[model samples]
Target: MPTHQIQIWFTCTVDDFSSSTLAQTFSTINENIQQVLNPLDAICHKPREDAICVSQLRNAKKVDEAILQERPDVKIFLPFRFLFWKPQDLFRPNTYNRFLAATGGDHVISLIDEISFRFPPSPPLSQIDDLPQELFCNGDNRPADCGPNCECVHQVDIPLNAIVEVVLVDEVQSPNLSHPFHLHGYSFNVVGIGRSPDQNVKKINLKHALDLDRRGLLHREFNLPPSKDTIAVPNNGYVIFRFRADNPGYWIFHCHFLFHIVIGMDLLFHVGTQHDLPPVPPNFPKCGHHLPPITFDSGYH
Candidate 1:
């Protein structure tokens, strides 16, 4: 396979942040990319002429002009402070003249701090166009979206055996926070993490090569399969994982972060199998009924 050129483009100040956290995060991402995209040269932090690094938005015009100036190739990772601009002042419906004016609606990855909501508050256009069908609706069971008090489930009646691949991202989402995401009756393999944001190639993988490289920097050879109830994702960096579906039901894959699930992270994996569901219990509440837990963590509440 040809070496894929994925740029880990992020902007940070030399003044504020220390170099250590950056190093550790970068190392984690480097090892992760090396493991997953084997025989592929994953460039983490390459300073190319094409890459755009913006710090202050002098005005909306400058932001627009600069973004248009540097036609980014793929993932555009925006910094945190950038999103602080008021939506009313910028990116309005009438002018429709904000950052969206610059680029095509390609895959843009924003560096959002998961713990806080810094991005703009607006419903995605699709929802505004038309409300989607209610597959399953428990009185606000959607994690993260709904506060801790709500317990809701929107049943899609999705069959099993449909999903061919699943990637679990550690960090951003961990097992302990809200809903313990459980894939009923099937298991998946864990892929490695993405490119490191700090360190360059040789230095980062050298450490993993010392420990995880049983066959010389090949991590899959040293990967440990799952044998636990809840999978714990890393905190700082993200994880790339894979899984398959063989079971036949409306399976639930949610964040173990209880509040996270309650918000909107909980999703249904409908494996498409051609089989009838087993008989319901004697006192089943309803087809899509949700039995409220006696005591759930108040993280979302």
Candidate 2:
């Protein structure tokens, strides 16, 4: 029997080996197998020469190469290797535009943190009126204070069968924390992720992202974007994703962190109207308190 030769590629950062023994072992392994100290160096380190132009807009000019070169290095957190370091910027969108021209969206939705609405000064509850009580009820019963004017629920209604584009921005206050946002029913294509190139912009928020979009600085990769149900919104940055809303029902989109979700770092995406949903099954199990009225028997002692 003949043995087949196998090639191994080890990838890591310079900071991976903290202990001398581990570093020596890695060095020994490198002598026998090829190693990649930093994989992103090949992909993102070099300056992009091609101009990024948006096709959806008529006669859109290509974005300057000089501006694209200013994007920050893509950082990542290896939880098993480096557990103590701050959360890092793991990914960024492709430098040039692709595929989006062919797959244009029907609706654009903005996902923002409390900072956008000034939640700390004003409560984090939903201020929008006429929200359905069934949607805002805590468990099966509505809170005593909650009424037709839902003060406890925050949600966005999405039309059925529409292609939806979401612009998710990081909170200005927690610039160092990466939020892992998850949508319940459908996975989305993460087409873009980036921060403002301007050094003067200390924090990137929804408004900053809008301004960048207006200036044609935010690029979207519609061609072969990774489909994900959950994605980490880069620390101090923003992420743009798109999905087709064919599902007709209520869905929650929220931060994966339990504490964050508890504190209202989430919202409901009411996809389509109640009419779009299938009829409830007859005699289906229901939620709510059910109790027979109790009466003291006269003969009871």
List the candidate 1 regions with Cα displacement exceeding 4 Å. Answer: 1-163, 170-182, 191-224, 273-276, 279-301
Worst 10 residues of 1 by lDDT: 53-62
- Give the TM-scores of the predictions, in the order they appear: 0.33, 0.51
RMSD of 1: 20.9
Backbone atom clashes (below 3 Å) for every candidate: 38, 0
Top-lDDT candidate index: 2
| Candidate 1 lDDT, 1-301, residue by residue in tens | 1111222222344653668866744654443332332112222122223221111001111121212221212211111101222455545565532232213442111111121221112221112123233323432233455322222333333333332323232333222221223555555433333333444432223233233223322222112322222443333222323333445555555555443443444544444533434554466432212347667677967
Flag regions of model 2 displaced more than 4 Å.
1-151, 172-175, 289-301
| Candidate 2 lDDT score relative to the true structure | 0.47
* Top-TM-score candidate index: 2
Per-model CA lDDT versus the true structure: 0.31, 0.47
